[model samples]
Target: MQLSETGRGVLVSGASRGLGRAVARAFAANGDRVAVHYGTRADEARATLASLEGSGHVLVGGDLADPGDAARVVDEAAEALGEAGGGSGIDVLVNNAAVNLPHPLAETPYEEWAALWQRHVSVNLLATANLSHLVARRLIDRGAAGRIVNIGSRGAFRGEPDHPAYGATKAAVHALGQSLAVSLGPHGIGVASVAPGFFATERVASRLTGAEGDAIRAQSPFGRVADPAEIAAAVLWLASPAAEWASGTILDLNGASYLRS
Candidate 1:
């Protein structure tokens, strides 16, 4: 089994802003060329590309909910970064794109609830599966070592009362990673996931500072939530060659807010 430890090509999905952006920055800072992928946030994606620490980074845009678009996103990223790495495509794939909208069973109508659940499943679960297959196939075909790190959520274990779809899909993601890790081990491919609690990201900045900020922070003994960069650091490590043995492991980044026995 061969595992690479030097500079590589990384593809970060949903990297327009927030945790995805932080993960992209972390990999770029570690000397990896990054392909920043976005759904609808083109300008924000460009900003993320600009913030990377090194060169050879590129921008890729596509709606991952669609299988065709998902394939295009991965192909474009590989084409763009392959040249820099001698035709060896992405060495790392970060499945960071997800949707967490509120659709409480008690409050939401049946139509809206079903729609939201389908949307969440498509973007959060199916897209991750599709991208993972695409990248893993390329690695296997090329006979190269690679890594796939999924961005799961604490809600997968703790439960999201108002967003059951989000929680359920994230749980599926965790399970998917474990299954892939086992299947891909023989190919020298490492697959792992991180389940993070509330973090300081642009998407939830208001919630962090508004009426529920105290309650949210109080959930963790640290009296504060995570910084996006903190989660990114964990992702960077899991993608490294040293973390090959950690495949199939789901590392929690919840700051002691949630625990599973």
Candidate 2:
């Protein structure tokens, strides 16, 4: 039940950008060796690794949307962590990679729908499951305790009409976390998902820029968008030992907007 992550290892998916990068850097600063998983942005991943707080954090690029690639990335993380001063398995697995294609359901093309659905399922669900399976195996093999943190969206409950697939996929992720928590609890592995609302991420900010971003911020109860670090703070807690008993729970980090409104 250590509060800090010293002498530990973590694997963070989608570390090339956004929330994943923030989570990875948080773990690195706290005392864990990190495996930076990037889907396409190798340079960004490498740069993130370079800027981390500790040595032994490594950048490993892979498109986790592919079934094979998902397992491969976890295996690589395990291997890298083993070589990085700890003779143990990775302590944390973060599933933070996702994509959303906004389209009205009525006008959405079948191909477009399928593509977006596939991306959401493959990357957000399949890949996360694959890595969790690998990490869970490694944890059992080493007889070490571990954690799984899935990055979900407020859409899980908010139910965005234009982002139906994204919302549905996240709702599915919530179900997956519950199942994983019950299934993996016997092996000392905890599973959970953290859903965020109205975070001012670069990708999101870019999309909802100008008046759109302002409106989004205003819609929230707090009347302001969340700082990325705020999201990272929640992740840091979930991965920390203090939260080991908490599993199968979807923590909603909204500013009471989603709940009260």
Candidate 3:
């Protein structure tokens, strides 16, 4: 009943659908065991686990907005993936869980704007920070090497007029990853982040239709948005041993839609 003892244990947060699910699949296909974490979508998370290419994948449920719940989620993942004499069990931590809701300045009330900002900060920035700390601390104690790949957004560099909170928090995530990369590199733990533009995810299916979709596709010269698999592939590579040297890097997956000097 113990999962594959040969592969590394991977924990991917917010993996109920879209990019998170794609990332989980990529890791599973690479022969690693994945812990799929979901906040409010147990059924979707289960489906994600079922659709994986291999066995030994587990589902973890938690509302990461709460610090206590976040800690518990990390502990559960480590315990589930731990081997008889294995280290912390989880060798890779993917901080992919986030909330992106719109609150346009002029159109929203002050109270509503404040509440949305708080929610965004809790779910997107703080959860990621806490999870990274938990995983990195364990890896350091065990004297093992690991990787942390944060799912950031191109909105961080560009702009999210309608979703300012999302953009700001994602920028914080990217900064956090870079700082961790510098500090964790000495411990053989590489940390990196990927900032992606609009992608084909269920959450954005509505925006990718008809005239709106056409405008979005036109953002990139390629005349199309990215497939979730494309971003997942980059995440997979970043977690690989070969990518250690590329630590502290924030690879852009926006397909030239937004460029920064």
Candidate 4:
């Protein structure tokens, strides 16, 4: 519950680039000792670590598709953050790593469709669940308060026709966060999720310049998509003690692009 200017230890997964990198920077700027976790981009992860405002940031690399690797990543992050913060365990866990692949039912073959579904479910849902469980267990054991912020997608509430698995997994993520919130609340752990619409990140830069750019922007009344920093700011706030009462909430960061009744 004590996250001061000398902030808490935080772990940001898949932080080599895009939204994950932005989230990492936000926490570091708040004086948190961050553990930047990446799947394959070592150089980019190192760059993220270097871009952190405060010192004591570390880099962790692992493929979350494997349950073992997911557990190891959390363990390594906890160890590194604890060492950096005078043996204090990680205070925040950001589940931002995911596999978002487009597989239109009309265009994709059955074999490829199955593979894509497996990949998406494994990384987006299973991996996140594993990480959350590990982190929650650690916090409970230590009798410490912590936070878990899941990075979901607007497609969960709206729709992703081309990437049905992505949408489904994100929906599952939101539900998982709520379930965890209820279960972990008594342990002083907060769990929440943010469902963001299209953001202008490196991954979708080309899409923003393509023929569908205008349509995408028009989805929001602002006439533009979200910026990475905006999503990062929401995440930073959600992971803070100030948002403890907001647990079990699946916050919408879609810029009014999609509203559900």
Candidate 5:
């Protein structure tokens, strides 16, 4: 289905780089006014804004790990986009900020292991929940139809031995999206998630170039990990009005890397 030419206000968290940046660009390309949200990376976020195709794009900065900051980020985005587009609130939200620090049980110490889990859960799960709630409320108050797309991980199903916390939080995110889909459907809001495996983002580019590259590629029959833009495309589709019935769905973008029965 083709997207509407009329511009909508979109807020993409973690838009400074990687999949977030790509998602922001994708929405902008479709004529939406986007709020590019970053965490302590103003320069990179500006670069993302500059790369977008349209005007009315704004830059918002906040650390998602802090609930207060997450709320503020949403408010700022809504206000900025509202001023630019003559709308009162955001039309779509993409929750893509997360922490993926590896803390292999065997090599890591107990203190660090515990810290890793806490940080990952705080940022990946709690923050997403907070932002979703804020955006949902705004959408409801404005009586507007909207979309929420959570960036999950294939590790949620396949497992992440080196980063169990990351996997657990992603799985929780998928579940959260499902719950929101049900609760918000009556209000004309669609909620869904995407679980991607081994994307070729800057954060993992070093590993993709090292000795483990081939093995990672072999995980998928395609013999290549996903490009950020591919993931961004899926996000765009899910956020479209055509995907309204797809609410509560968890779309897997793993390229057949880890099939779940």
Candidate 6:
């Protein structure tokens, strides 16, 4: 049975774990069909798909590092949802997958740095752009508007002491979201961003310095890191009807940790 005559499709990159899984689950909970994409970890991806709250979800497997593979992933995702029983086109597109390269400037190699840039830019920037274009075309053809949510990081602006490449790339993501908001708004599509502070993900939990991490914790007015669900909550709102008027805005989900206060 078709989820809908136009099965509201959502393509979530990196849906296997962490913040991506949280975002995927949120979309599923709201009855929007989702395509779970994962690279290298098919088992984990399958587990996530199995745990989703809604039905009509499909698992898409591929590595985003390859240009051909990247293009295929989005096409497959959009197609999977359509096969589930819809043709109205993708209603929501969440660009939640990004690479975080944290090596210091001098310590990293020239080629290493270049590769990091290429990987991050290709996955974080180019692939996302391609998907946006495809979805926008589909949405415009169907004469229906949609939503795109780009997950960003505080490191985008904070200019952290290390990870120069990651900082700069995320900064680009911020710009991309804004530009899409402007270009797509007139076409009936909405683009927004979720700039999350240090969430209590395994990545952050493993990096916490005994004293330094504690200090970062104290820095937050809440004295703790944000839960992934909190970030997911912001995403759910942005994709829902309540957030239609909230285009081009980056909802800060950090616990005031990096606030200027």
TM-score for candidate 3, residues paired by index = 0.96
**Residue lDDT tens for model 5, 21-67:** 99999999999999999998899999999999979899999989998
Instruction: Report residue 238 deviation for candidate 5 (angstroms).
Output: 0.4
Tens digit of lDDT per residue, candidate 3, span 46-153?
999999987778899999999999999988888888743564478999999999999999999999999999999999999999999998898888778899999999
TM-score of each: 0.98, 0.93, 0.96, 0.97, 0.96, 0.91
Candidates 3 and 5: which is better by lDDT?
3
Candidate 1's C-alpha runs over 4 A off are: 83-85
Query: Measured by C-alpha RMSD in angstroms, how accurate is candidate 3?
Result: 2.9
10 residues in a row with least lDDT, candidate 4: 1-10
lDDT of each: 0.94, 0.81, 0.92, 0.91, 0.91, 0.78
- Residue-wise lDDT of candidate 6 within 27-87, one digit each (tens)? 8887778888888778988988999886889898877767678778767877778733556
After superposition, the stretches of candidate 6 with alpha carbons farther than 4 Å from their true spots are: 1-7, 83-86
Ten contiguous residues with the weakest lDDT in model 3: 1-10
lDDT of 1: 0.94
Candidate 5: segments with Cα more than 4 A from true spot: 1-5, 83-88
> Over the stretch 125-169, how does candidate 4's per-residue lDDT look in tens digits?
999999999888988887788899999999998889999999999
RMSD to the hidden true structure, all candidates: 1.2, 2.1, 2.9, 1.4, 2.1, 3.1
Which parts of model 3 are misplaced by more than 4 Å? 1-6, 83-88
- Candidate topping lDDT: 1
Model 2 pairs in collision: none
Alpha-carbon shift of residue 96 in model 6 (angstroms)? 1.0
**Candidate numbers, best TM-score first, in rank order:** 1, 4, 3, 5, 2, 6
Name the TM-score of candidate 4: 0.97
Give the alpha carbon lDDT tens digit for every residue of 152-215 in model 1.
9999999999999999999999999999999999999999999999999888888977669999
